[model samples]
Target: MMGTSGGSEEIIILSDDEDDKDTSCLIVEVEAVKKTVGVLPVSPQDEDLVVTFSRRPDVLPHARYDCPIHPFMPTDCERTAPMANNELICDQCFCYICDKLASLCGMWCCSGACHCNSHNKSDFWNDVRNTALLGELQRFNLTLSEVDHHLRNADTMLQSFRDELSALFSSIPLDQAMLPDYNINQQDLSSRYGPVLECVTLFLNKADKKNSRAAAIMHLGAAEEFMRHFQVLGFMGSSSAATTSETIIMLLHRVISSVQRRIVMGDITPLFMQKLQTFYQNRICFPADMRPLKNRFKCFIFGRNLSPVFCSLTIRPWQDVLLVSVLKGQNVSGFRKDKGKKDILFETISVVLLRTELLQLQSRYRELCRYLRVVLTDNTTLYQHLQDLIPFFKCKLGEFGSALESLFPPASPPASRFTPPIFLLYLRIFETATAPRLTVSQPEQLCFSGASWEPIKDAVPLKRSELVKFALKAQRCSLPVGSDPQCWASLLKVVCSPHGSPTALPVPSQQFLHESRDAVIDLLNQQGYNIQISRCFLKTYPDQALLLLVTGALGVRILQGSFSPALPVLHAYKDNLWAFQWLCEGMTSSEDRLKSFLKEITQESSNT
Candidate 1:
């Protein structure tokens, strides 16, 4: 210990302190630790019971039907019965005493023995695998297996039809070019010019069934399955807008291929769905109105059709979901190259989704409306609907947001193709809006003063640097368990101006950059947030005015103590590639000097 000018003994401690005894006295007397635990955050993950997967409960795909399946047993009803010597009060109710009974697909049995008591065998799945549609389905199965020989078989079969059409066309005499038909032609045509030129009509106009007939049939069938299965049935088009034969062929064939694969792969579960999310991040966003068929079919085989067009519409056939992609819009090509209006790929997906499947969700719009409290802006309403159905389209918000960072290069970015709908998606996933919603301080106390987070030392709202000080005061607060995590992501990304480097302010508008930056620092100081979250906020906003966020707010305080966590924050800001880098480096390095200068009136804490 050394003597101070004020006559109190001054103790000095080093990093290699040999004794823990005088260290606390020297440090605590010289400095105080300031930390702020901001709002409680919504934990990113919560433990959910691992779905002990069994066979899915039998219900329609969208219907929520839950049934617990047990191990398979013999077909003997008597042996499986829970009660011996069947003494049910009623035959329908197979209980020995109670009238209550259960039916496993209409076969009355003990609830204890019957696994699917809710179902009736008469419900038609009761029609075992080889039931009502068995024969036709067996034939349909041939479509998948005999696929290699399909076009060849079709070519031979169509030859007869081609010949039939040829003969029919030959019979129609041309009136325009002096071939008046009937009397003279009928009698002597074959003997005269008939044998030489033939009736010619069928030969010129009709397709020779031998070549294209088979392909046409298969294409038609595949197209039908895609439209019908996706619940897009009874769809009609005019002469000006026909779903082209080539397009139908592409969609149908691709689906035929995928259907078999999905079947072979067996049932999909949530666990399987989660696995798919990993790869989904990098998928190029297709345009809203994308017809992905042509894109899909270019490299594949030109195989013959499996089903006829008419039959394709009516049949319940498995087909590829990938075929349902939207056709790229011609308008997309017109985008100004440098524009970032929307992402091209997702634009296509959104448009196609809106036109196709999203229409169905409109019915569910009423349900979503109730959830939104009916006061939702049009944007919020769209957000809710998209959130629910996004999984079905293989669109996960987390994955999409994660992907957005990669797709956009640091420089020379492409036009943002996100329409309003897609933009809504971005907002929900990336950052939640805190606009117009007042966020009070932790412990959420309301004194005679307005908000707990209101001004402490300012006459007018504090200038950029000063606001950071008041926000720092909030660090002293202690909140109740499970408070909402104080938000930073949204406030940090506000971008200051409509367009500019984020650091270039819009006349320093209310200094959101400063406020948000300080808020993040406060969060870090209180041990209120994770390292990643603190980093994300700091990374997003690095203005010099916001430097205290890392240094004065967090780094300086941590440096004087034995805390190690704040050191990493130092390394992170070292690069200064973003706006706050320079300030971050300076602040962390100048820790002691800044700490003594900033907090002259230090209060000792009772709790560690």
Candidate 2:
């Protein structure tokens, strides 16, 4: 048993036999061990110290901080020391000589520090500096090598493209002034001209046998068909058509020459010979009723007389009737001023005359009317009745009144030679006869005094002619999908100007309007607006301001993320509200305010 005393207190342990004796020896040894290794005292402040040790510092110190080898070394110390005449220093955690950390330093590593001592005179630092800078150089060299390879490839491709383009240009025919003369056969001619020759032959045979108006009309229609064919085949000018006509005339002349030769050789029968003789005999006989037909036949034989034939076919009958009834005074009662027959005759005459001949006929008829007024002065009723006919002609000719000034003597202004009088008349008729009536409802009257009122009232009227010209210009500017950027920009500038008012803008055609609307939609979509917004813009704005509004919307969309001021949030904005507000506030607002607003929105967007 073993006993320990603390402050005069003693304790003893008893064991059985030899086992107790061994236990006492073990206890004594344990007491001796406890005295050799003492326990440290612990306090509550120690827990705080442990926590502080475990926490990370806000900022980390430099690698050189508290370094044992270079304790006085600054954090920003250079590799070379200023002292000792710029001697090289090894201050890094990694040892240059050993090529390892300082903790792993050993004498056997890198053949000890004998090489480290020779740093000042050795080429080791120079080699290391070059290696450090060479990494970036290597990367730059790789990039430049790749760029040079691509440049060479691009040069080769460009040269190949140029060679291909040159070959293509060389293969294309450049001479457009002279087209090849194709050798067309009789079948090809018939297919191209469409029975015009047959009509001409039938008319010739009928005229030789009998004096008939049907034959004359048929020949006139055939001539018209021939002219139409010439136009379709790109014989645009009168000279071109006349030149082409020579070939046809030569073909007909050959047939006549062949017939004459056959007759000389006695190739025809007796009955055919008698008919041919009678046909020739009739050519010399000039009956009064057959004179117009004879004149038309003579004109047809001579290819150069084609224009006079077109005119004479329509004018000759009327000229004969007027000469016989009015000038010769043979049938004065038939053309009596009071009779409705004269009116019907005049109407028929007007309908048959071509646009080019209308002015000439009008001047001639006006002169005749003046002559009748003087000749029938004794018969006041007949004279007054004849005077009444002048108003009908005036009313019928009113549609071409604008052109009449240039055609007649007094004022001959330079007019558009391309525009036809019939087209102009059609435009006038559409504007007058088919124009939409302005019927104001009660709700419309109340909205009349709204913000759009003053601008609509002050808007200038655009002429139909101007609208047509603008549409043609826009068509030229348009591309397959949209329009050319520069061309569209110029057109927008013109329409957005003060002189070009939106109120009176005319639609040239439904197709043109649709295409223009589609172009505007495409432009808006390209500018990042959604399809609904693009359609809304089109529905909200007038046609004249379509391009202008689109351009403005794009500007606003860039700055404010919406097409207009009224539509601040594109997704949330109502289309109905956009239409109503845009017509009022958006259109009536001054340009300066809009510009300033755009500028502010741009600044705000940039700041955010």
Candidate 3:
């Protein structure tokens, strides 16, 4: 201890006497000068490092003993940056540690360990980072080139069973292939792969930006292949990469984001074709009959937040194929659903938004009652926004429920179930590479994150004004929009058509939607009523019929504690249980297609 002795201290005086010499000799360490001590002696086989000092009793006494160091002789005063501020506990990315790359936050990723004694900046270590970063860049480029090439030249990339999934995930070597598994411990890794993981972490961390958007697209293709290979070969033997939840999340995000970006670009890449091939094969994402895998929540959260771009893409034909993935209770994605196996579906998105939007908004407030009162006080935008989403909300509900049935059919496994499967055939045709060959009847419906009618009346001939007036009047006066001469003709058609119960308008096929819409408008104008999907059933049928019919088909038994039932289920919420109301409505299909569709919907609702 650096302490001062209080009171009187005795001072020793040197004497020339022989007795004095003996005392002086006792004060000196005989072994200290004779022995050579090492800084740190480490054996290749053992991580344990031994730092030894000469066995000298005299020097040991004068060592001050605060810390057991040798006698003062310029003892090293080891220190690191003052323990980072209690409030400033930010951790640096491995890239910052290795390659000196900055985080999305424009600063070099740093941590207490950045300059730790255990691992510090040495020329050798510095060279290791620089060299590894170079290889990482090269690997990045190589995988990028492979994905881009495959996306362009289906001829070469999609040739065999092996050359698929180059879009969603990539196959970069650990160049210093230290940790073959993602779960390798930091100390266990080649001290090089840390930066690589950091680079990946940065990519996965970003939320809603363009740069991160494109990379995920390319990675998904490769991930698709990697996962498939994992399923077939069981090559890695339950290592973290093979079974971690985080890896799976990253894998799905990459594929989903890639498809979205490529589709938006209107460029059909080879990976797209490969995906089509895979779809037709009814191949499992992970091989069936493999050992069960556990879920990794952290990685899934990262992927979920990073996946806005992927989430926005309206999966027309693909949802039918992808939803078949019975979300293992262990492997659910971003959606915060408890029933993971059945919960994550496109329809489940509404549930997420409902929970998240409120939670996020609430986080910004101190008191719930004050905020609730504020919301109550303002009917302005809040009420209007809610009103606008009504039509869109209904569609989401239907789509979500429908997704559950389509995706998770009971008593059927993925691979063996699709024999002469028409559903598989449809997906393949949609995914086919050569050219756009779509049947008129097999029209692909385009779902929307937003709604039509109110939002999209600009496309209609009669101004948005006239349409709204009719809808409002229908609502207030209890008159079908079709009952008025201006609105009556259209109302009758929707009322007369067997399937015309309109709790939700159908997601119109892109090719046939405009024509159906035009048919609806014309029918309204000519016949004083209309048929087909519409904004409100008031123009066609009474409120009772529409509400009862739609709710019945939904088949969701409402749970007691729900925030909002009028919601859209993005892919994650497909299996959310709604407290459904059922009726004993007899839906017998007579002769008409409309009648048959309605009847089928009704019958299915009751039977289920």
Candidate 4:
């Protein structure tokens, strides 16, 4: 029995196997194996590695050598062996060094060596254990280093993918002139974007394999955002082409989504078309097998914001198909939940207004108001004048007018009237593409920064009202003098257009009026614009004449200059007529162009 050097346990070998019994013998076999395999040299620390084992003190004396009597010597030559007294018995003729089993053999000890050439037993035994442990540790470190390398590579790939995605978005062709010549081939787009998406998918797979929860979630979100850009591009394409059916468009979207799922879930071995075909067929039918896949796709696309998804899923497919079939000349159904034509018309107008009118007002008004506020607050004289034109209180008494009237009585002195110079400044700044910087006569001599209000003011206007009246009565079609601008400018155009029915506009009454007001308010809120001030103004002045006047003045300044003392304002009126005519010119042309495409589609479907 031998004890391990570390004192963990006693190794008792009762086997008849000679090679296994001796630790030195095992070490010799290991060295031979190393020579056969040709492994690299281990760490420098392993150079001194030694295997060690302890022997029982009681068995030390009984140690004996297994050597045959030399043929050259007489049979009388004695051998070392264990004695009946359990002790080593060596004859006088035998080598003294050979008598000690644990000692190094000398020249006289069995002709300088025993059966084993290794003379130092301690070094042999220690090396055996040390080499085994070192081999295992080397393997563990190798694996760890490989994983680290993989993660680093993935990070680099992710960054490259992000850069490519940015380039794709920034290069989108928005101009109509560029669209026909745009050279981003569909096939090339697919080829370029595929690898970028796959890199992200691969990173996600690796993260999942490593059980990195945070990394997996982050990559998943990034990939989703990446796909969102494509989705928006798809919408813009549909609007531009107007050839693809909604079904085909939706399926294409699903195809991309399906690719993401397959890649991330480790199932993307098939060809691209094969996967797309499978998803397309499966989605159109909604097979039981594909239900889970569809649900997962929805979950990823919408995350927890599932209102639209839930609504879409719950609605019957036949109903959607039926509505599409019927909408040759009619408005699209299944878009909004409203059942009445009047309500749907109002809702559609609300959506258009939010996107166009309210957005323009909120952005332009906020900027103009901020600068005006700073200017007015700094100079009381300017403030007093501006307040007179705008009225700090009220001009008339109505439902909510009495309170406003009390705040600013008509009988009071005219301290609030705006001077023509400052009023013209206010008008000209908004009218031009670039608002000029002002040096206000205040204590600080503040120089306000210029803002570009072109996006709002420079947009094409809808002039169907003038167009219709011009066709009906040529000489009488001029814009009325001293008239407030239309508040429902967009809707008025839609209703007055040749294609639109005059009856679509709701009759003016308490109910219809209240509904229109609510619709406007709701649209403003939905667009993330604060309508509290607008709402109060609308309620206080139900005619919307004041609101119209303010916007009309801005519009008129864009065409005809107001009376500011600045040179820019003085020169603006000469250019205003041309500018207004140009802005209004596109309205009819754009409507006609859009209608051409829409009518083609509707007519073809209706005929079918």
Across 1-608, the per-residue lDDT of candidate 3 in tens digits comes to: 02236643334445445464565533321232366677776668567656676674542211111113321111122222322221122233223223331223222223433222112234543443444433322222223334433233332222232332332223434332334555565454424333434434444333223232233333443444555544433433434343243444454555554544443333344454344334423322543322122111112232233332222223322223222222222223423344465332332232222322342233321121122221221223333333222222222222322222322233331211222222222222222211121111111221222313222111212222232233322322222211222222232223222333333333223433223333433333433212233545334333323323333222211111121112221111122112111212212122243344445546545665
Question: What C-alpha lDDT values do all the predictions have?
Answer: 0.31, 0.33, 0.30, 0.32
**Ranked candidates (TM-score, high to low):** 3, 1, 2, 4
Task: Please write out the lDDT profile of model 1 over residues 4-72, one tens digit for every residue.
Answer: 786555666543556657644444256445998898765646455456768944532110011122322
Cα deviation at 308, candidate 4, in Å, is: 10
Model 2 stretches astray by more than 4 angstroms: 1-355, 360-494, 500-519, 522-544, 548-608
**Predicted structure with the largest lDDT when compared to the true one:** 2
Candidate 4 regions off by >4 Å? 1-293, 296-320, 330-567, 575-608
The candidate, 1 or 2, that scores higher on TM-score is 1
Cα lDDT tens digits, model 4, 1-608, are 44557535445555556677565433211122243666887998898888798773332242223222211221122224222322222332232234334333343324323312221244542343233223322211222222344334444545555676667565654342123424445554445444545554555555444323223222433444454554555432333232222222243343333333333333222332242334333323332322454433232221223211210111121123333332232333323444553222211111121222222234333222222222212224534433332211111101122212222343432322223232223223222213332222221221233522332233222233222221112111112211212212322233221233332222234453344444443433332111123345346433332222222333332333222222222123232233223323323435554344345535555665
TM-score of 4: 0.16
For model 2, which pairs clash? none
Residue 113 of candidate 4: its Cα lDDT? Answer: 30
As for lDDT, the candidate ahead, 2 or 3, is: 2
lDDT of candidate 1 at residue 113, scale 0 to 100: 38
Q: Score every model by TM-score.
A: 0.19, 0.18, 0.21, 0.16
Which of 2 and 4 is the better model by TM-score? Answer: 2
Candidate 1 wrongly placed segments (more than 4 Å): 1-160, 174-401, 411-415, 429-608
